[model samples]
Target: MERPGWAPPGVDITTPTSSRIYDYMLGGSHNFAADRAVAEQAIAAMPHLPAVLRENRRFLGRAVRHLAGEAGIDQFLDLGSGIPTAGNVHEITAGINPEARVVHVDIDPVAVAHSQAILTGHPYAAAVAGDLRRVGDVLAHPVVADLLDLDRPVAVLLVAALHFVPDDATAGAVLADLRDALAPGSHVAVSHASDDGRPPAGLRDAQSIYARADSAVTMRSRETLDAMLRGWELVPPGIVACPAWRPEPDDPPSAHFPGYGLVARLPHPA
Candidate 1:
């Protein structure tokens, strides 16, 4: 497979990347043939998928706005942030505060490459290539260390990323470690795939299609999702559908989004 100019040196252009696939779903141009192929297959199975992804992106924008505007957070760490597309975190939140900084983390080299390229003149934002499951490495990373202050409030976004982590223990540990590392008043915004209703044949096929990609899908029940969010204060409209979390008047109806979204905050010291 010929590597496109946009793809990074170490990336395998033949195998489908989950990030690139997601990029394709969001109508972005950063994906390769393999990724597009997988995305098409998934779409064929579950046609509502593109709408779901768009809703997730909308949810991301709302989450960032709330964290920066309402919570007064200046630092942002977006975990598993897929390919840089419209409505990026920095664009949404950084204007509110001049000193605001953002560090986007993703496992895909293509995503890192595109993000770095797009962020060239944007001094306050950057991207790092690393697996979010390794909480220690991400926390200790140079980009993260430079842009984020451990003692200051930061919003950690896990948008559409947790489903790729198949192991329960690893996911829990990652969340727990992140919670312990941040200062009080920090917030975590998550939008996760759920196994609430019985999946149709097409949706099941979509899962199989993702299995062929770089990471397999793992949908958790609402109970497990709530448990994973222990020790945090759930804000109003807690743990609702993505659009249901905080929908703007012009935003799409919440019914299109089929997953759960929540924003939980760590309390300040009494």
Candidate 2:
């Protein structure tokens, strides 16, 4: 992506980034021309790319609010948090409980810098840079330790991020590590790209476009995703279309969804 004048120094503008492309899809001004170009390529493959991204964001808000309100969860650990956008995990949770503490994690240095600048001194929020694959490092981070109390229930938000984890082994290892650290009552909410309800040929071009980006895309099957939730008890609706997880009254009725979302809780050992 061509660097925008507003972009900070030292950030690469040529490489196509998932975060930047996501920002573009969300109608944000933070993306560059290079990002927009790649995003258009994706849109060409999937006409509803923008709408799908928005639906995913909306689902994220609903999941966070549900965790904060119904589950009495006030601590959050958001992995692979992209560039901060409207109605992020912290925003949604804080709205429900002002005392809620959130730690946003991502591997992008640019994202870390941006998050730091915006969330610094917010008291309840902290931004830390780390690969989601490095579960040990993420859990051991001082920011995470200081903001989130692992002994109590917490909400782990993995919105539109985990699908980027290419290998099943790597993804499972990361999830297992997180599950081990979370309390018995902790909730895990995730939204992942999928091809379950569509023809197999529908995802080829989209996958190709993502292959050219900074991160590779991994569209998992429902069975694969379910296996990843081995110990957690699924909430109502189970794994369904992102928009269908819990649609708002104002949401348009459509079945052309591109992702799956669900909220689940860790079960106490018998």
Candidate 3:
């Protein structure tokens, strides 16, 4: 299959990716036909899928705003930042402080390509292709090293990304490594759908669709999320449902979304 102009070479465009599927969910034009097909299947399974993703995206924007505005952070490490759509991390941060630097890392080459294309003239923002699970590689990438100062306060966003890690042990270890690497006053934001209890029939079908993707969705329980984020200090209204966390009045109503969202700070050295 011929690769789309927005897609970088050497990446498979015929296979659907979670990132592109998410792009489609958010009504972005960066996704391919394969992505739309899988998204359609998933949407048929659960019509609210798109709404759930939008709410999660809003959570990311709110978290970025908090980091750039109130937390006084100017550097952001956005892991698994899907195809940039409305209210991206850089966009949210730019609105608060134009100088705030952002590095968007995604495993999908196409997403990285699209980000690089859109962020061409924006010196403060760049995109790198890397897996968030590989903390060492991601933090050491040239883009990250140049754009972010690890010794200073930075916001690391894991918005709707952890659910793909699957194993709690691996997830906990990654978070611990991040905590150890970051300086005092750093913050991390996360949003995830828990799989502790029985899933609804529609959600079950959606999960089956995601299973075909390279990084299958592996929802963790709220308890597991807390366990992984143990060292960080929870911000107010801690770890609530996605839309419930510091929600703006203009945000759409989500009646029963199961995803959780939180922003926690790493305290200063005592």
Candidate 4:
């Protein structure tokens, strides 16, 4: 397959990446044939995959609004940010606070390249290539350090991203390091996929498809999900289904979506 002119250097265009697969699911055009093949297979196993992805995106917008509007956060760090699409973090925050800054980090070079292209001339926004599991490296990135102030309250978004991280220890360490890096009152917003209420065979099939791709999927129990947010104070309606967390009146009910969304805040120093 010939590489597209827009494709970033050093990225394996032949392999299906989670970021590109997700971009395809969200009706974006940044995906390749391999990503679409695996996404289509996963959708065949679970027809509701598109709806789930949309709901997760909505959850991300809602969480960002809360952080920017209610929490008064002026800076954001979006981990595992996929291909830029509608209702992105910077766009949502811009409406609430025009001066808000955003740093988007992703392991996928394609995603980072597209994000950088889209954010050109936007001084407050930037995109960098970094793996979320490597907390130190991501935090040490010059783009992140330049855009975000560790001493100020900022929102760290992990929406629909953590499932790709298979190692529990790495995930825990990432969260702990993030907590320690930010000043008191920093908020963490997460939306993670869950196997609860879904057919076992269907879930397994989807997992298998993702495992064969560049990023493997790992669904966690609600209890395990809750445990991952330890040491942070959960906001109201804590860790509920994506749409059930302070949903808009007209938002479609997401009871069938196998995912959880929550916002937790680190307490201010005593």
What ranges in model 1 sit over 4 Å off?
A: 254-256
Q: Which 10 consecutive positions of candidate 1 have the poorest summed lDDT?
A: 251-260
> What are the clashing pairs of model 2?
1-34, 2-34
| Candidate 1 local Cα displacement, residue 40, angstroms | 0.5
Tens digits of per-residue lDDT for model 1, 129-174: 8889998899899989988998898899999998899998888787
Highest lDDT model number: 4
All candidates' lDDT scores?
Answer: 0.87, 0.84, 0.87, 0.88
The digit string of per-residue lDDT tens for model 4 on 22-49 reads: 9999899998999999999998987778
Clashing residue pairs, backbone N/CA/C < 3 A, model 3:
none
> After superposition, which runs of candidate 2 have C-alpha atoms over 4 Å from their true positions?
1-9, 200-202
lDDT for each residue of candidate 2 in 1-270, tens digit (9 for 90 to 100): 365565678888788789888988998777777778889988888787787788888898888888999899999999989889888877887788999999999987777777888897899999998998988899889989888888999888888888899999888777788788888999899999887765434466977887788898898988999999878899998999888887889877775676689999998999
- 104-139, model 3: which lDDT tens digit per residue? 999998888888989998889999999988998999
Better of 2 and 3 by TM-score: 3
Candidate with better lDDT, 3 vs 4? 4
Where model 4 places Cα greater than 4 Å from the true spot, the runs are 197-201
